[model samples]
Target chain A: MTKQTPLALWRRPTFWPVALLALLWLLNAALTPNFARIEVRDGRLFGSLIDVIHRGAPVMLLAVGMTLVIAMRGIDLSVGSVMAMAGAVAAQLIAVHDAPLAVVVAVPLVVAAAAGLWNGLLVTLAGMQPIVATLILLVAGRGVAQLITGGQITTFERPAFQFLGTGALLGVPFTLWLVAGVTLLVGALLRLTPLGLYVESIGGNERAARLAGVRVRAIKVAGYVLTGLCAGLAGLIATADIKAADVSNCGLYIELDAILAVVLGGTSLSGGRARMVGALAGALIMQTLTTTMLMRGIGQEYALVIKAVVALLVCLIYTPRFRGALQRLVGREVHAA
Target chain B: MSLLRRNIPLLASVAVYAALYVGASLAYHHFCSLRVLINLFEENAPLGLTAVGMTFVILAGGIDLSVGSVMALCSIVIAVLIEQHGWHPLAALALALGLSTLLGTGMGCIIHYLQIAPFIVTLAGMFFARGLALIISVEPVPIRAAGHAWLGGLGIPLTGQLDIPITALVFLGALFVAAYVTVLTPIGRSVYALGGDEEAALLMGLRIGRTKVFVYTVSGFCSGLAGVLFTLYQSAGNPSAGVGMELDAIAAVVVGGTLLTGGVGGVCGTLIGVLIFGTIQTAIIFDGRLSSWWTRVAIGTLLLLFVLLQRALTSATGRRKAQHVSG
Candidate 1:
């Protein structure tokens, strides 16, 4: 093989997302005062940059699973609700049952996985569209969480549980470590096994894969179960960070963010291509955008507007029709010139 | 029998709605009162209007998540203008409705022209409308317009204790108009054709762009109308009002007997859906034991049941078609 060169890396599709993220980071550093300022306090790193990643941990975790799900041409809109449910389960277990940390964490993850399994069965067995299948949970999952928490924001304070949110293991945020570990573990699993290829094949063409003897149903269910696990962990992080599980508000609109991140990371909604690093960068880009606006003293109302504009711009840029129109317009000018 | 089989979903919704009303009438001593029955129409007037529009959009095989945001925006614009700017209620309503319809047209243009997903385009619309509304005023604004109150006051008296409000009358008028349009109008037929199969419709010389745009325009207008009527009904316009109304409308449409895949349901089913929705809320309120959140849970369960029933019906038809082909 030809010697790998830095210039050759530019051909990679993932390079653009990473480069965009870096450009955004640099812009934040230049514009927002003290944006690049980093501090070490109590042996833990702290700063706006750190804060963005720390806050973005939940989305980053979600992006990993969402990448896989979207690669399978399916979406899990219930991630936000699953987050709420998981958080509620954890909070109730801690506050009401006075469960240990292991039980507090384990039970919620299991519950979240069960919710994923429900979605999987609905889509695969019921043969319902993925959107319709997940829409059920999206609608009712929050109510179930409210039922569990008795329609109250359940708060629990256990030092170990809180550490998952607040504590540091090695002068860095625990959330960062958790995210990194999960990403690496998932990445390794995807790389070292045929699971990723099977997922891609399933997304590329289900009928063909089924004809080839792939267990499409089982694999699809596994993808959802994986997403559920990710959502569960994200929920635990959110709840632990606040020490309260706000049933209605804990993970509101997060699934939208994750979907946007996945899309931004260059995952096709039509299925078959997955990007891990790109999605991570996309989630980071969102966090950075929100932070940059906050630091610039922009009103909260403008944030959604900004997000809409960015999303629209990205959508336009990605559409082949729009691109063709742009090229024809430019080519016409060039011919005239 | 074939017709009935084809519309099993619709008939099922009616049966559920009727059963709920009958069950409530039995469970609660005064549930059958004219007041409660009229209140169902009154309370659900806005939702009914939006869901009716949503039915048309879903029928065309597209979804509009921006309805709630558009409603909130229109409501806010009307409130800000009529209350804060001393504009006439009718003038303010016209402006708000115009702006909302324009927003819908813009979204529809993008979705049609750019070939973007409806979810993404409407999501952008949702954020844009909600952001604009929030920027207008984060606080709730109560209408001080005398005309709003005057219209609110005009209602047909059935009993000494109750009268059908003008809001409900507006909804009923729209419902009749929509039903007539859906059944008789070429545009309505075009919408159904486009929804059932866009490729076939296009090949058959349907104006795909116009139909899609028209569907969104109607949805936008309906949502704006709903907001205006709701403002008159609630006497206030909250920027955050109808935060999740689109999902509720979608649920109502689905539960009322429409498929999300489009071209399989009607506005009448949507009305039954709204009535069912109102019945559940009112029944829970009367029961005193059920919590507010249970309304959502109950709706979800019903939605699931209806979906399964639809699935079974469709599969049965599928089997029949297969058997016919083999024979």
Candidate 2:
């Protein structure tokens, strides 16, 4: 009898999503003109390719943190609002304090981390469900953001900040590189450390994990804190991208998009599983699809409807119940074949 | 003690309301006046009505994230029918309600038959309704008819001191109906059972599907009613009306002591929740020193607190049950 290692088992689910994304990229390149161009001038990379990478960066950041959170059988609906709030706070600091670029950047991230800690405490100590606990933030975070900005768009005249969003590294956009770095860091943490095992065990069965002496509450809190930090990072990218902090529109509906990316990447919403590479692939696929639709002159409104439909279809395909129904519909002959 | 335990949400909600009132009164000189109180109720009437309807859905172990969008759709439909087609106000109101109910029934059917998650279904419903509203009209249309104003609260005098909003009266009336249905009806009991344990309720002969459909339908009807009330109070209808109001309704419902996981809650709790939510917003304004942004922060904090309390209580009970079984 041969025993399959855990690493070997993990390889199977991870490969397919990446392969699918690759196929999508190839298809888009073949179909769309100038789809894969990356050019460098004045030490800056620029193109539709880089734009897609930058635009998708925030969501990718979110997907990274969300993957961990969801791996623990929890969802963070407040990421969008947190992003908005962080952006609002970050922009406010820049506006009010004439703070240095680094300090301006650091303040919002800290605030976001605190917000995440608050969510963690609620979930761990208060024992609230993740969805409901995060929801309080989801509902109020935006309002806090608005209040921070005095219900106005806050703009900063910082070139370095804009560069984070728009600059390049070795002809690759800074945002893309950031995504790569974060993904690698998160990937390494999940694969190289005991943290991944602990998260998985805690998610798989909390009681068993507790009995095994796992600090479940601390780990859950850490997941939320990580999520908040990521959200704050995304907020920085978002604010830098537009060169302004627009509280009302920044990071709106991002939570849904991030969740979609995670789900499409083949991560189960029902915990005990984590897929870092799949999330990267999922984020790429989402960006590619959106870019393709928009470049093809698809109306933003219709694009939304299409995205929803595709998301639903993807969910149906991935969902066990829906897959089972599909298999039953196809009958035994197909299975036998 | 059992009664009190069963009604902790109600008690907590009342306590919050009282706290808000006292806080508001101390903060603002005119806050305790009847006129100010009436004004507050009038301002929040539509939201209160929606909260009442939401109580049913949440109690049934489901959520309607589309309520705000549905209200927007209903408002748009009513506005378009009255303003564009010259339909009478009452007829437009009925048609909007009917359409909203149909939408809710369709959502119910999809959830029950397709076995789709309520979260997904309602999220889609939100988009569909919001899209339909935008498609109906891109701009806000003022409802100028005297009859429309009457429906919204144009002519009623409250003790000859201030104009009474018909929306408030309508909201109160809806609350009464919701209270009766939730507390007095077998269907309501069935809803609680469904929330508690669907399979067990099914084995006990509850018509699970029908009960769910009924609650959703009622929810839709209330949303439509809320639309009419909102349009009347605002004296206009915008395609973007009621955006994010669903969160407020959910917040109110949860704060009112209705469990998000469902089973135990009532309209009375919801009434207090809405009032508390409204008071918080009013208090933010009254404080003058606080930013309106604190309204969300305050509500968010309170929501987290209540949800945490509920979680602790439920988990404690669950632990006790586990201990009982192990022992």
Candidate 3:
């Protein structure tokens, strides 16, 4: 491997996503007064920046799981719906019965893990496409969630359950800490373990990976199960934040956003590459975009438009052809001068 | 043996549809009526149109997640033009279809020029279309135009007390044209060849770019037609309409024997697939024992089965092809 110069490094594919995130933060700071202000409010950190991470915790966690799934040449459209299902299950347990804290948390997490396992089985053993296989749950999982809630937004009145969403630790939001911990853990796993190499080898070329004695099936399955677990935790946080489980709209389109985050993080949709910190940056960028749009009195509808444009621009920037074209255009201008 | 091998997917789809329809007819007395049968097409005309369009995209080795959103945008555009802008109904309809085609072509341009994956490209397209629709109108806009009412009311009386909706006829018309183009046209053949293998098609001197762009444009046109039919059926345009419709369209195409990996499906199969979907919904509704959500579960289950079945059939066919080559 060759050591790249600073200019080359800046021109590398991974640099743009991070730069774009920083640019968005700058934009937010410029537009909103006191956007970067941090103060201890009632023994907790409170500010727009803190709010971004706190709100973005669910997506950040999802991005961590999705990075692995995409790394293995697969996608899990079921994650968003799985979040709803998990939230619904937790909400039902707490609302219907004075269920113990462990039961409420454990049941949903297990159900979500099973959902992930179902997706993994469909993709591996059944020889189905990942998009279509997970799409089955993307469509039906919400119905299952609704059934669990009996077609109602089941609300629970448990302070213990609420703590997962609203509680703080050491002047920082608990959600933020959870997200940071998960991100680091996933990052370490990818960097320090052989699992990451196995995943990349499989995604890069499955036949070659199989020839090299990699357990392609197990790795693929683990990828989805991890994603499911992440989604389940995100769902619990979401339901706890609201104290209610709205199956239909809960976690709606979060999968698309997660995929977008992964893409913006310089991870190719074709797979075989993973980026942990980049995905976190991508998630924060998305949350900041949403927050900025809302702060500017932009309708949620227009926010979708802006996000779509940003995603398209990021995707276009990541394309090698587009980059080549751009560089050639700049080179032409420089030569003419 | 050769004929059996070739027509297995089509045969399988027909068999599935027949079984579901027959079973429903036997179980529910009212399900056997012609009105009930026609109602299936009427209720699902938009889905049928969208599915037909999807078959083209998928057959060309691409997927369009934006069809549902495109349909929604078309409906919104038509409603806004007619009611809010005071434009003629026919003119508004034309403009809506034109806009949809333009959107599709734009997406294709981005995909081809940037060499991006169709899934992510179309995902962005979906958001853009849906957002634009909501921006057009957050609430449902009722079509009070006399022309729209006429269009909506246009129907043919078949038997004693049964009238066929114009929208259903329009669906059938779209299906007919799709079948004709797919079977008899050079462009359609090019689409299939491209999907079968892009490099080979390029080697064979096919118009890869034109065929790719044309398929997406055709899909956009179908979505536009579906949107118009939806508006006519409901007499209003809701921005949120056609939610999850892309999935339904994809499901119909897959169930109809079209391969998701691309290059092996037809409009005829898609038509049957749409009918199977309608039949399932009808059966569940007639049963009344299960909630409507069960339709989603049932469709998901069927989608899974059909995808697995296609995999099996394709593998068998591939094996036979290999044997032939060796022999």
Candidate 4:
């Protein structure tokens, strides 16, 4: 592949989501004082923008995986529940079992991936619709998490976990680096291997993909597994940040936000063709919106309304019929002029 | 036998509901009386109404994640109008229902005209309604109007200690209307046709947009009614009420033997599903040893079972169709 110039990169489809993020930040800069200012405190950068990255990391990670699963024409509604379950599992290990940090982290992720395997198998083997199959876990996952914690919030005090949430590398937040590392790793796997192609093929036409000898079931299942892994990591970060795992509220409504990010990134809900960078920018946009709302002293409740409006606008802009109508209106104005 | 097999999901749910109720009644000795039956309907009125509405949406190959939030919004609106402001209870109810219907219409128009996915649009509607409700008030609002008391007092006494609630009557009435619409009305046929094949329905010159909007309107109206029933039953409206009720409603619909893929079920099945759901809750309550979380697990497991049942029926039909065409 030829290297893309900066202009060429901006011309690509991934540009709009980033452009929207930049526009949001610019609007915030006008509203709040020092909104764009990045200060170095204790050798770490501090600002609303940096704070956005830190707060946005979990969603960004979710979007990274969601972009792929959605590209495979499947959705994981259970991500929020999986986050609760993962957090519960990790917290139980840390607080009760007195496990090693690595073990605490690794075990939850494996469990989360197994949950994904269950969703995938339902879809592939039983021929359940992806939405229906995932909905089962979405409903039951939180209950399972609550059961794990004995119907109580589980709190843990692990220095290693806290450091994972707070520690920085060369003035950057650890979560930012974590998001970057996971994105890069997933990006490499998608780009280097046949996984990306297989996803697009199955999403575009499953029968055609099967006729072409693609491992449709395995690939589709792998997509969900990857998503679970990402959600698991997100769970770890969120739990570590709070130092507690509240099964009921951990990662609540996050799957919706992740899906919104994917849609804003210009990925069609009908599936096919994953947008990696677009999803990252979409996550940034959501975080920026939230941060800006807080800065403006707007109540947190209003953020939902604003986010919904913005997502609707993004969806409308992506709608072919809406675009055509806009074009016709513009064409009429040009002719009149 | 074929007919029984074809209606296997409905039969299975009925069987499950019956067995659970019977088993619990035998074990607890206080679960099978007329009082418990009346109480079950009263308690599950909100969920039952939501499930009926959800049935319409799902039968049209659409999903409405907004029902839960819409119900809360409706309850909040009525609470604020009746308590905070001086509006009459009946007037507030009408206004809330109208507002919710308008919200549903907007969502349906967006989904149909702008060609957005129903889930995405309704999810937005969910947040929109929830945020609006939160903006109104986060605190629980009690309905204390004189008229509300009168309405609440109008219950039919079955025995000295047992009576049927107005909420239960409203739910049953709504269920009757929904069953009629889905089974008898031409509009209902259009819904099934649209769900079965949108392209084919369009080719057949069905009023697709109107039917789509009508489905959502029914959903919105029912959810608003559910909220009103819930407020009456509980005597208060909490903004965060029914936070995850959409899932429960959907679970009930799917468990009732209605295919989530659409075009294969009715509201009557949903009634049985709701009974199963309520029975699970009642059983857990009676056992005293089981936690409430088991209800969620039971719901999930039952949903899986029905989905598998639906899957089997769909594949069998598909196979039969293939063989017929080939022969």
- Listed in order, each prediction's TM-score against the native is 0.96, 0.90, 0.96, 0.97
Q: What tens digits encode model 1's per-residue C-alpha lDDT throughout A64-105?
A: 998999999999988999999999999999999999888999
Note the Cα lDDT for every prediction shown: 0.89, 0.83, 0.90, 0.90
Query: Which residue pairs show backbone clashes in model 3?
Result: none
Per-residue lDDT tens digits for candidate 3, residues B221-295, read 899998999889988888899988998899889889888888888999999989988998989899988777888
Q: What is the C-alpha lDDT profile of model 2 across B1-327, one tens digit per residue?
A: 157776876787788889889978987888888877887888898788878888889999998887888898888888888888888999999999999999889888777866666776677677777767876777888777777876665546768668666877888889998888887899988988999889999999999999998888888888888888878888787778887888899999999999998898788888888888888888778778887778788888889778867776777778888998999
lDDT, residue B251, model 4:
97
Model 3, residue A164: distance off in Å is: 1.6
Q: Model 1, stretches more than 4 Å misplaced?
A: A1-11, A325-337
lDDT of 4 by residue, B10-114 (tens): 888888888888898899987888888988899999999999999999999999999999999999999899998999989988999999888888999999988
Clashes of each: 0, 1, 0, 0
Across residues A29-99, which tens digit of lDDT does each residue of candidate 2 receive?
Answer: 88888877767778777777777777889999999999999889888989999999888887888777788
Model 1, span B208-300: residue lDDT tens: 999999989989999999898889898888789888788889999998888888878898899999999999999999999877889888988
Task: Evaluate candidate 4 and give its CAPRI docking class based on DockQ.
Answer: high
How displaced is residue A191 in candidate 3, in Å? 0.2
- lDDT tens readout by residue for model 3, A161-252: 89999999999999988998888887788889998898888788998999999999988999999999999999999999999998888899
What pairs collide in candidate 2? Answer: B153-B166
Ranking under DockQ, best-scoring first? Answer: 4, 1, 3, 2
**Chain A only: TM-score per candidate:** 0.93, 0.92, 0.95, 0.94
Fnat of candidate 3 is 0.67
Better of 2 and 3 by TM-score: 3
